[model samples]
Target: RKGGAEMTQREFKDMPSRIARLPRDKRGFPIPKFVGAVDKKGEPDFRLVSHDHMAACVRRNLCWICGDVMGTRKAFALGPMCCINRVSSEPPSHYECAVFAAKACPFLSNPNAKRRQRDLPEAGEVAGIMIERNPGVTAIWVTRFYSLMQVSNGVLFFVGEPEGLEFYARGRAATRAEIKASIASGIPHLEEVAKRDGRGAMSELKRMRKRFDALLADRVPA
Candidate 1:
C-alpha cells in the first residue's frame, strides 16, 4: 500500500497544472503566491488574490459580455479589429474585449443589425446542441453564427447566433420574433455554439497539419 505522503504526491500529479496553479488577473485579481508554511504536515499552502468575493473566482474572471469563463473563451482574429480600450474590474482576453465592444459597434448594434432574429444560446446550450445535432447534421462551423452543413447533402442551415444570416444567407427570409420568444422561454442554444467552435478548431487543426506535412516533405535527410 502507498504511504500517505506518496498518495498525496500521486493525487497532486494527476491534477491539471493549470488548475493547480490557480488562474489570476493582472489588474483585478493577481494570481496566488506560494506562501510560507501553514502547518507541520510538510505541505505548502497558497493565498489566492480575489476581486469579487460574492461570485466564484472563475466567474469573476469571465468574459464580461458573455459571462464565459476565461479558460473556456474562444479565439477570433476579428477581436483586435473590433475592439476599443476599456477598463473593467476583471481581466478579460482580447477576444472577450472585442466581443463586448461588438455589442456597441455600429455593425452589431440593435438599430444597425441587418438580421430580424434575436436570442442566442448560452455556452452550455451550445455544447449540448452540438452533441444532439451531430447525428442529424453532417458538419458544423462557427463563423459569426452556428452553421449546420448537411451530411452528404451539401446543404447548410443556421441553428443559433443569427448574426451571420445576413452575410451568409443573403436574401434569406428573416427569422420570426415569435420563434425567438419561444426559445427564450426554454434553454439557450448551447450545443449550436459548441458545434461551431468544435468545427472551427478542427478546420484550424487541418490547416496546421497540412503546413506541418509540407514542411516535413521539404526536409533534406542527412
Candidate 2:
C-alpha cells in the first residue's frame, strides 16, 4: 500500500456502497472486485472497486493491479507458485505487476516457485470463479499474487495465483539456502495466526504451506 496514490471524494463514498450491493455466489463469495480505489491508508479494503468502475474495467480489459486499460494484450495472471489442485479465476494484470509482485509479494519471492500453465474451466464448474475468453498470453510470476475474499461466514479467504509466468531482473537471486531460511522464519507468524483464528484458519494456512512444500520438493538440487 506504500506506493498507492490519493483517492477522490466521489470514489471514497461510492465504492463501499457498491461492494455491499454486489451479488454473492452460492458459497457466499462476492464477485471479485476490480480494485481501483483504496482507503486513506492506501489499502484495498473491502469497500474498494465500485460496480460501475469494475464493469468499465472489464469492458476495457484493464490491468487488475494498476487499474489502467492495458496498452498491450501481453499481460500476466498472478497466482500460486505451487499448483496443488488450485485454480485462478482472477483477471489479467500488467506485465509490470508480475515483476512487482514477484519482488514485493512474500510467497512469490520464494526461490522454489516456477511458472506453470493453469486451466481455467468454464464458469459453472466453480461457484464464483469466472474466466476471460481469449485471455492474454498466459503469463505468471514465478512467485505469485494474493487476493482477499470475504466469504459467507465473514471469514477472509486468502487466494493465490502463480500462473502466466514472467520475471524481471531487479538484482541477483538469493541462494537456495537463503530462500529456505527466509521461509523457515516466516512459519512462526503463520502459526500465530492459526492459533489466534481457529481450525478453519489453520487449515487454510496449512494448505498454503503444502503448496510451498510442493514447490520446495520439486526444486532440483543445485
Candidate 3:
C-alpha cells in the first residue's frame, strides 16, 4: 500500500516526486487509476475511466490517481459544478495527486480545452447529465468523510462537506474572478435541475451554494 503522507496545502508547479512515481503513458502523463484499457494489449485511454476501477476504489478506500491505499483524509478533484452538486462520478484521490491533476490536466485547467465527446463509451458516463463543459476551475475537495451512492446503472461519490478546498486554474491558484465566473455560468443549469427535482433538492442546492459563498470569499486574487 502506498502511504501517501499529508503534504503542505498548495498547488504544484513542476511535477512532484510522488506524482513521478505513478506509471506514465507513452505521452508521459501519469496514468490515473480510473483509465481503462482500450484493447487486449491493455493500452490505456486517459479520457476513458474504468467502471471496474471506480467500484474498486470505493470498496477499498483507494486513491483515484495513484491506485494506492489512502490515508484517512480522501480528496476529490472535481469541477466547480461538482462542488455545487456535492456529487462526483470519480472517487477520492490523494491531495497532491488531485492538485497536480487540477493544475496539469488540460481539460480542467484550460477553459478552452474541449472534452472529446466522439466515440465515448457508455461506461464513461455515470448516473447524471454530466455537465459536459469544463468549468475552467478545479476544486480539490479534501475531507475525512464521503458516501458511496448507487445511482441508475452506476455509482456516484456523495462528497461530504469539505474539511477544506483549493481551487486551481491554468496551472496556478485560481483567482476569485475566475471562480466567480465559472460558478455564475454553472448555477443556472444546477438551478434548473434542482427545480426539476423539487423542494428537497432545491434546499440542498441552497446549502451547497451557501458553502460556496464562504469558500469563494476566501479566494486568491488575480
Best by TM-score: 3
The whole-model lDDT of each prediction reads 0.27, 0.42, 0.80
- For candidate 2, report its TM-score: 0.38
lDDT of 3: 0.80
Q: Model 3: per-residue lDDT, tens digit, 141-189? A: 9999988777776778888867778888998888888888999988888
Q: Which 10 consecutive positions of candidate 3 have the poorest summed lDDT?
A: 5-14
**Ten contiguous residues with the weakest lDDT in model 2:** 130-139
- Each prediction's total of clashing residue pairs, residues at least 3 apart in sequence or on different chains, is 9, 14, 0
Candidate that would win on lDDT: 3
Colliding residue pairs in candidate 3: none
The per-residue C-alpha lDDT of model 3 at residue 23 equals 72
Q: List the candidate numbers ranked by TM-score, top first.
A: 3, 2, 1
**Which prediction has more favorable lDDT, 2 or 3?**
3
**How many Å off is the CA of 63 in candidate 3?**
0.8
Give the per-residue lDDT of model 2 (tens digit) for 1-222: 346954332221112332334344333433334543444554443323444554454567665555655654434443322122243344445565544444433234444443322331221132233222211112243323444344442222233544343322222233445445545554565567568989898888788778756654555233
